[model samples]
Target chain A: MYEGVVQDLIDELGRFPGVGPKSAQRIAFHLLNSDPADINRLREVLGKVAEGVTFCEVCGTVAEQQRCRICRDERRDATLVCVVEEPKDVLAVERTGEFKGRYHVLGGALDPLSGIGPDQLRMRELLARIGTDEITEVILATDPNTEGEATATYLVRMLRDFPGLTVTRLASGLPMGGDLEFADELTLGRALSGRRAL
Target chain B: MYEGVVQDLIDELGRFPGVGPKSAQRIAFHLLNSDPADINRLREVLGKVAEGVTFCEVCGTVAEQQRCRICRDERRDATLVCVVEEPKDVLAVERTGEFKGRYHVLGGALDPLSGIGPDQLRMRELLARIGTDEITEVILATDPNTEGEATATYLVRMLRDFPGLTVTRLASGLPMGGDLEFADELTLGRALSGRRAL
Candidate 1:
């Protein structure tokens, strides 16, 4: 019952993850009800990101110029580079206020079934950064899934012979707020397997 | 390390509904790692939606101009208006290809606790449309929840005095594919309370 632009918006919104037909329509209506100025701001920022944003040549992170903010930060620990399967992992880690080191964004985890391999990722660039920079430690921060484990294993083997390079993986355990009884078998199993000395 | 623009994109992605901290970072990284042109396209569309869209004056559905296309169509049955709470409801009805009438979007349902009242809705415009137009029947297609019920009741009472106006509400009960046993008590009660003879 709407104009072409409204329909176009609904179509576009439906493409987002978890936004079904009904939800898409709701979002479209929300946009329609909102002030044009506010909507335009979102559009403008998105447009700018679309036109001007790009990947950092060094570590495969998004950037407007040549390097990403974290990579360029002078205060970050250059010697400790955290490797993650995706860009979102970096943000999650950062939000915790725990990490003050640089990052290397691997486009994706090692999905053998999906045919993704070492060549598909920016592995060569990661090796280059490790070789040239004064990086003393490489932290594997990929997800706890099979693909993540495979990727981590591959990286560890690849960097085994490199001098002065210490490879470490993020610890796996039960979540802080989760109960021991309700924990899934796999997670509880992993927590048990990766147990540490007191 | 990498660049700052990628980090900015991740931060923005985190703000979307259902996008967790990790997922947001992943999407941002994916966009950064992908071709610049693709990322730019998404941003451009997002920005354009924010800037270029608005609600239709007559129907409150999303539109590029004064009225939605359905409201503007001369051949549509202005006499049979389907009233819904949101623009998304319009789409759901449209998908069925059954109704041949126009629509009146109420912006939202009645929620007293939330402080929403008749003043907050486009009730004036709706009444005006009914008064001026040759509307004969109205279908109240709001959801079955309390807010939707209240909105429908409010409309029914508001339009009761209009001459030759047939006010009908959409039936509520079990979904077509749903198993009766699995249905919650409330839905089962509605199905029983609204039962009809064959």
Candidate 2:
């Protein structure tokens, strides 16, 4: 039962992924009471991103230029490419500070039930990128989910015939934080099945 | 580390009141992937509000013109004014559909420690509004918290001598939803002290 514009604002804020009605109301009113200058700054940035940002032509990560910094930097290891489902996945892997390689975003995972197939992805572009002599190994670093696994499997089948190309799926096991007793049977089985010679 | 613009967008999203690092990252990336049309709409509305919305000159609620809709409506009971601390409080009281009267927004609660005093509030404007011929009663409906109580007490004292003005404070009691056993001692004491003979 709020005023029209206020209700509109609350409804819009609630459409965001995790923001519920109560939170949306709180945020909307907070914005209503806040100084216009601060709110304008946020609006400006959002507008700029929508207008200026685009997916990297080389890797599909968000960028203002043709290629993302990771793809453009000459110092990055061109021999190693980490394949992932979405641009956000690229950030998740980068946060660990362990991988110093380039990335190739697949736009989305393969979900056959939803009618998504290999042709919908940037498979041809990835194949062309790999055709260059600089790349030696491709790391399948997609999420450890069913769709991600299916996408990785599809990529493996498509790229297997390329001579001298070594394809490897990232390892899955008990999480660093996990309790063995609480682990599900399938996960425990996978942990056992994928055991390494320690 | 991400490309500079992605990092900038993440930082900007994080500036919202309750959003944390992971949430900010997710929203930033969602915006990155979302249809540019939707992002443009949000930006347009935000810009519109920033440029056009203003405080009602009469009651201090958010408005697009000189007065808020409630105040501008001739049918509303101008004789009774429900005084509240913030614009959001006005919306909450309105949602009940119980108050037939209009509202007087105090901008914020009284907090001497925070350097907010009676002089900083809209008390003078409230007095001016009440002194007019049509007004009959003033209802103090500030929140039950310490700051709200202080503000209500200040209003009561200030309006004690107004001729023909019926000054009344909203009753303090156990909320309709609240468990009596879970209520704090002070609130329980108030509930017991204010008990009516049924």
Candidate 3:
């Protein structure tokens, strides 16, 4: 423990995801030793972010206004919607520079064990958007885990009733530049089953 | 790569020690998704810590008032002073519950390459404290690296001029439960050199 305010700062920092107690102490001390101007800047930015940032009305991604940047961009393919679990996933997909479609963040994947269901997510908004927007394809880009698979399967079954809508899942196989020997059984099996001829 | 305020939050989080860009984005998004009440609490705590916390005038440790808790406690041994590089080090030593003395934080170890000399440290305060107080023993508890060793050597040389003052360094040896086979050469050598008769 430390002085009252120092301990309070460490406890607050420890609440952040992935920061352990040791890391919290280190960061708290670092901030304490840093320049007053720098600390003020960080504080200003944190307060500004809390007040200025909000969820996009259309797609649930983080935004400064009613709509996120991707949703506001008319150059992106409106007919194709990439459904992801979180806003962070939107950034992950964007890093490839391959997907040029709009995104719908589901807030989180379905984990019945954790009490997360379709109604708990933004599934209702997603369905409404799909029906109103002239979307032809919906790509499920959730994580490759049990919760993600369950969410995708549920979506696929529900979207089946849509007359012209097509649904697809991102391919799961060996990663680029990865060795075959080190690949896991499920990934190696998927790669074998989805093999292509040279 | 993100909306205005979101990107600003990420950039600010990335400035923290050991937090990379990816971690910054993750934390920013996590904060965005968290309840506004929680975010406000964190912000309040940060502001409170920055405004209220001040360095102890007696020992240079973190405090909310003029002196630190340890320095204010009359029951502690005023005649023994443990010199460390940072306030965090004081916590580490206190956790051991072995030292019942006061502390003197040097701010940082002597690293000439980093332009940190004796003048840059709280060395003047330490010398003044020793001269004024009835301190009989000074323990050099700096880290066991080049900078720490350099600082200890420098302090020992400087303190030699004082009469009837005992100077000591913390014992250097293999850590508890550490395996001999895995021990580095330098550590093993120190363990051998500092071997006890028990």
| C-alpha TM-score for every candidate | 0.73, 0.92, 0.93
Which residue ranges in model 2 land beyond 4 Å of their true spot?
A113-115
Q: Scoring model 3 with DockQ, what do you get?
A: 0.62
Clashes of each: 20, 0, 0
The local lDDT score (0 to 100) that residue A5 gets in candidate 3 is 84
| TM-score attained by chain A of model 3 | 0.94
Instruction: Name the DockQ score for candidate 1.
Output: 0.36
Candidate 2: CAPRI quality band = acceptable
Worst 10 residues of 1 chain A by lDDT: A40-49
Question: Which ten residues in a row are the worst by lDDT in model 2 chain B?
Answer: B44-53
Distance (Å) between predicted and true CA of A133, model 1? 4.1
* TM of chain B, each: 0.90, 0.94, 0.95
- Write model 1 residue lDDT over A1-198, tens digit each, in one string: 446666776676666555676676666657665676766555555555556666777777666567777777899999999998765577678888999889999988888789899999889989999889999999999888899999999999999899989999998879999999999999899899999889
Clashing pairs in 2: none
For model 3, the superposed segments whose C-alpha errors exceed 4 Å read A196-198
Superposed Cα deviation of residue A21, candidate 1 (Å):
3.1
lDDT comparing candidate 3 with the true structure: 0.91
Best by DockQ: 3
As a TM-score, model 3 comes out at: 0.93
